[model samples]
Target: MKFQKPDFNPRIMPPKLKVLTLEVEKFDNNFAGVCYKNGRRYVIDGAIPGDVVKAAAVESFNNITYCGLLAVVKPSEKRVRPKCRYYDSCGGCDFMAVGLKDELAFKTDYVRRRLFPFGTEVRDAATEKGFRNKITLAFEKTNGKLNVGFIDDKTKKVTDVSECLMHEAVFSDLVKALRFWIEDNDVSIYVPRFGTGTLRFAVARYLDGQLLLTVVGTKSLPSTEDLYKKLKKRFPKVGLFENVNAEKTNEAVVGDVKHLYGEKFIESEMLGIKFRLGPDSFFQTNAAVCGKIYEDALEIVRGKNPSVVYDMYSGIGITSALFSRVAKKVVSVEIVKKAARAQKELLSENGISNVEVIEGDTEEALKNVAVEKGGVFFVDPPRRGLSGATEEILRFEPKAVLYLSCNPDTLVKDVEKFVAAGYKAVSATPYNMFRATTHVEIMVLLEKIENDE
Candidate 1:
């Protein structure tokens, strides 16, 4: 069912919500719960398996529905108090009520269950911990003062979250300090009304105990120079500073960037390869787990060193570089022009001459590359799964295809399609990248059937 429908009424609950007892079966991901309500299959929220919770109807759209906890009819043995104070209202995290260790286990199990339908088990999956590296908080004004927090679920109303459990303690402190800094300077918060103002967003990255600040606004901020200078003065170890003016109505930071402090970008090492990350480039939030994920992807390309490797949806080219080292040639396909350009620059700077950046849709770009008789194809599509065109390209058949997905439901659906297209599922590896949340990332390796034409 499409989640594009209008918001559910707050007063009207879903029908049969009260009578149905939810036995949380498994977690789909953050914001979704898999449970059997009233002896029928149902996806519930605010309840997990082994927790006998009295769930009250919250909302229902199409076939999917949401419920709120009315009483703990029963509690899971592994359940624990959420660490953040914004657990109830703040929408940043959906698994705050789950224990860290148990949450990881549940995520792993979610992947395993999804693969069960295909008769594949993820055996070598790792439970990566302490891997959260980045987070984006909404910037809004509350009580006539600038406040940094996440918006309530299904609403633009800001929810004040002083403490976010996903981030390290220092990062949270930076958010607080930033709010004070903006308020003290009397800078106007960029309101979305006709899109005219400065101070739209403040995204900070914590690396090596140093923060890289990127301030975004609808219009250029006049005080950006002074603000950067003051922030650097207060925090001596600030690594990089940038100001981005996104005049467009979208949330993405797409504008002329001014390097207020430090170099144009900062360098971070991942999977033994160097990556250049600017404020605009996309990188995995959990860096350490990403290293393992990259390693696993490399393992799929082991021994059978192909003449060419196609890294589809190559985000910032991290995976592209990793595969380039082993393959005779690697071609990275990405739609974002800026990120593709950054990948090109990084490849050139690192003296990695074997890789080429193709800026376009993966499905279209892959058709242009002349893959040798035995070449590998790696596709990491978005949560929505592969594009229809990309799916058709996969049907054309490659030696081996490595499918990396952050959502199991979509992964299962896509894998089923691959299996139907004469691809054999050789292996699947599940990883718990997001702890204390239902999110799980998986790597699936499939090979073309010998009988396939």
Candidate 2:
């Protein structure tokens, strides 16, 4: 079962619709609940579970129907006022309007709800916090003025974002410095109309309290060395890297990464295990709390030790090594070649020989890999969740499946597929990666049911 492209266009729906009583059932990726109305399902925003609201049907795109909240008829106990003034304007933080503790509870419930089909034994699991190891920020320059912010969900407009609670306090100053540098250098801003210019994006990730900033632009930076030097002097904790996009597109990723500061890359530790990260390597952003994630994940694999483990969507193979200590062997698959190289180098440098880093798409790679019976499987995929074909691969029925996700709604849907395949979700733990946003990360453990039983 390959992942099919959605056929529906999002702009086909009415521009404005009459408000109707819409009930939000659960969080799905960046969107809210799947609203039920008059035998039609409208994917709604700003409505949480247990909340009844008057919503206006809006756009439909790529098989997803969207609705906006017109009025809240009934609110959930989790609802709260967003702390940041930019929360409503900036689309980066959605769940900021909801209580932090309740958000965790909602994410936890979503996991338990998916496991309901496996057995009657359902329990509320404890969640962890403060463990984010990766974060990305876009750099936008309009009319020779530089701005660092996120894209608006509704209008797709870039709003300058400075103070995100989820980001470290030091990042605020970095944004200011980058803006000042652009202004000082009189560098031409990259315009979609012109298709060439200077700085375009600034992405930074924190691991083990160390920060790595990657500045992306359309052309070579003139003051890359100076900027790195100044930033290193200002904040010695941050390692700087410069990158060029060069491509004439809206994509934020860079084509080439240049080491401007530090030692070309940075290293972080988790549970006595060390891992090296390059400029573009995918890792979590919140540095202080990922230890809890490693601990909780290790607990899930406790009784199942001395087994081979397959780590799908394993970014840089950090989690792969986390499981390698207890497991007999760990094979981690990453789609990006650069990340796979980094994983291989890091593992080899650390003298870790039990793990194999395969570079290929997880769904495509899993098609060829042999899944030995009783081997533990861990998948930490992107927010889009598991593809239908990827779910079908679970038909091999590994002993236990530990799913780590940043989106709860997709987790629920994937859980449905797993339940259908006769697997039971045993426990889950939510970890707060984006503190001020609606996004949450969860680690779920599921056990496979024997066919004869």
Go through the candidates in order and give each one's C-alpha lDDT.
0.70, 0.70
Tell me which residue pairs clash in candidate 1. Answer: 24-49, 52-74
Q: What is candidate 1's CA lDDT for residue 225?
A: 61
**Top TM-score: which candidate number?**
1
Candidate 1 deviant stretches above 4 angstroms: 1-43, 59-66, 154-156, 190-198, 234-256, 389-396
**lDDT per residue as tens, model 2, 1-453:** 422223222334355565568777767645366765566666666677778887665655545556766667888767777788897667677777777677666655655555455553434444445544555566556675566777676656577878667666766777776767666777566656667667677777765556778888776777776667666765667777877788776667747677777755677677777788776877666654456677777777777774788888887777787788888788888988888887887788678899978899887787777767778888888989987545645755688888888777678788778877878777766666666555557777778877774
lDDT of 1: 0.70
How does residue 21 of candidate 1 score in lDDT?
64
Measured with C-alpha atoms, the lDDT of residue 134 in candidate 1 is 67
Q: Write the per-residue lDDT of candidate 1 for residues 1-453, one digit (tens) a residue.
A: 454323432334456655456777666545455675454445556666677766665556656656665556778887777777777677566677787667666666766677877767566457665647665666777678666777676556667677766777776566666766676778777667556557777776665555677777665565666666665765655644455666555454565556676545667777667777776667777777877888878877865578788788997888888888888888788998889998887787667889888999877776786655557888888888885744645644678888888777788888888888877788888776776655667899888778736
What TM-score does model 2 achieve against the real structure? 0.79
Q: Return the lDDT, model 2, position 366.
A: 76
TM per prediction? 0.85, 0.79
